[model samples]
Target: MDQAPPRVQLITSDVRQRAVLAGALLEAGFGVLSGPSLEQADLVVVDGALPPSELAAACAQAHAASLPVLMLATSTEAAREGIAAGADEYAIIPCSRQELELRARLALRHARARAPIVAGDLRIDPARHEATLAGRPLALTPTEFRLLSCLASNAGHVVGWQALLREAWQVEGSQGGRQMVKTSIYRLRRKVQRAAPAAVRILTIRGAGYLLAAGSAPPRPPTCR
Candidate 1:
């Protein structure tokens, strides 16, 4: 069967705004969901007009489930509150369709990167944007974690320099280019070594790019006896 479009859960009290956002998202190739169950949602878009208590609770709940929350704020105050409540992204209300769609695309793309990915004894938990090596935590910054997740997800494949730049830095033609990517990779490897004294297996494929070998698997949850 063909894969379903990435689902987005839209939470808002305003019927008109919900309709607008939903229409824009639908046109942008996303499945619009309206409910409390967020398990399958790639992202959550909520009205910025929500009360602070309500917004904070919603953001916290969504984050706990590894879902990225985007908000439509009515003003700068609302936008700041949205961020304080853990919104991953936000736009002041009355945003252009292009802006909303673009933000959704970026949020979903980044959130998908957070999903748990495994390579060798290394486990990358997208939910928390965290990585564990040999069962020990690696102290990776956000950019490093995102870069590592991108590599780990495509284990055994030479992810090109341009691709890494796009995935990690979200840019195509920055001035630093490949050098920027190389520096990040160097820093990431050093961090990985802190958790696993063994040589970090992320390989630099010269001319081709970077690769994480494919001997990894997601961490399996313990079973009841």
Candidate 2:
């Protein structure tokens, strides 16, 4: 029997943004440990708009842990400083959710590629821009791949619709103009089902959002236990 992967630890500044980011990662399936205090983090992701003293402190803590640092900077100059201070990566915030997921996975992958492989049947080769289930290729549209990659990276957690839209579509602001997210999820489900076992699932939480089921269970509609 195989064991599940350990969760990713996330540290961020703004509570609202942290909540949204946490939910997104959870829906994608990572056990998230959050703190405004970067000293306690395994992976410190900080706001670039923060004061230099604070950002520098966060970087110091990350360096102490030997943990990778990702910064959400407000400007190019800030990003440069973050790198100079030892951040592994820096990106502008309000980015599409797809970009976020891709970069996050790459960061982890770069860190753990030689550690050991914990992921299961789903194989995402970011470099190839491709994914396969149990060695069988999935016919995923590019958008669907980005969405699935986002969710799969944090497999056991719940991802909200708004975050998904931002990542998958790159549309900005807190607006829900259409319910096309549901449509994309549905299509992703069918594509995965074609090759995955019945036990693996993509569960939906009412009023919360969608997430891939952990382990091999096929996604079930949300249920009350």
Candidate 3:
């Protein structure tokens, strides 16, 4: 199935600004939506002219839904508040439309990277936080689930340890998370082994990182002697 472009919800009281921003986003290959529907929205772009409480509430809602938020802050103070309200990024007014588009593109890149990823026998649904192996559910913790999802997203491709930390645990520039990844991968392997021992395998790459062996049942990380 062909996937649709990531949709952005433009929230602004200024009709003219909203229209202009929406048009720019569409030109940049995004599906534009007006009004706030976090569940339906892949990302949110709101105006700073909006009441502070409302901005906070909207950002909060979008974030809780795992939707990324971008705000149009009119001033430095507003930008700070917007961040506090949960916006991942905000632009001061008079900001170029090109910059706005780029910001949205970057946010969507990270967000979409984590969307549902499927391999042969293993199916991973990030939205539902569930993974199934050949019709059987694999027990996974939230962390374990994310780890598996990251590996599955790059199935058959070697994933570096740092990449796994950033993608799965959201940890960056820290070696501490390495141990967490190791332990989590170990547990995840056990779950997969129990759920569909004949199907999936999480491959450890020694000095490198890990990967999810591709294809269907009998998938296992190859041993290099």
Best by TM-score: 1
lDDT of 2 by residue, 1-225 (tens): 865543556655577888877776666655567434544444556677777887888777766765666787778888899888766777677776666666566656554432222246777766467777777887888888777777776566677777677777887434442377888988888878877765346767778788777465455443211
Q: Which segments of model 3 are wrong by more than 4 Å?
A: 1-3, 113-150, 156-200, 203-225
- Score candidate 1 by lDDT: 0.80
lDDT of 1 by residue, 1-225 (tens): 998898999888888878888899898888998767998888889888888888898888888888998888889988888988899888876878888888887777777655689777888887666778888888888889888888877766677878889888898957888899899998887777676756346767666787765444332222210
Using all chains and alpha carbons, the TM-scores for the candidates as numbered come to: 0.68, 0.45, 0.59
Sorted by TM-score, highest first, which candidate order results?
1, 3, 2
- Show the colliding residue pairs in model 1: 114-126, 119-216, 120-216
* Pick by lDDT: 1 or 3, better one: 1
Backbone clashes in each candidate structure, one number apiece? 3, 26, 0
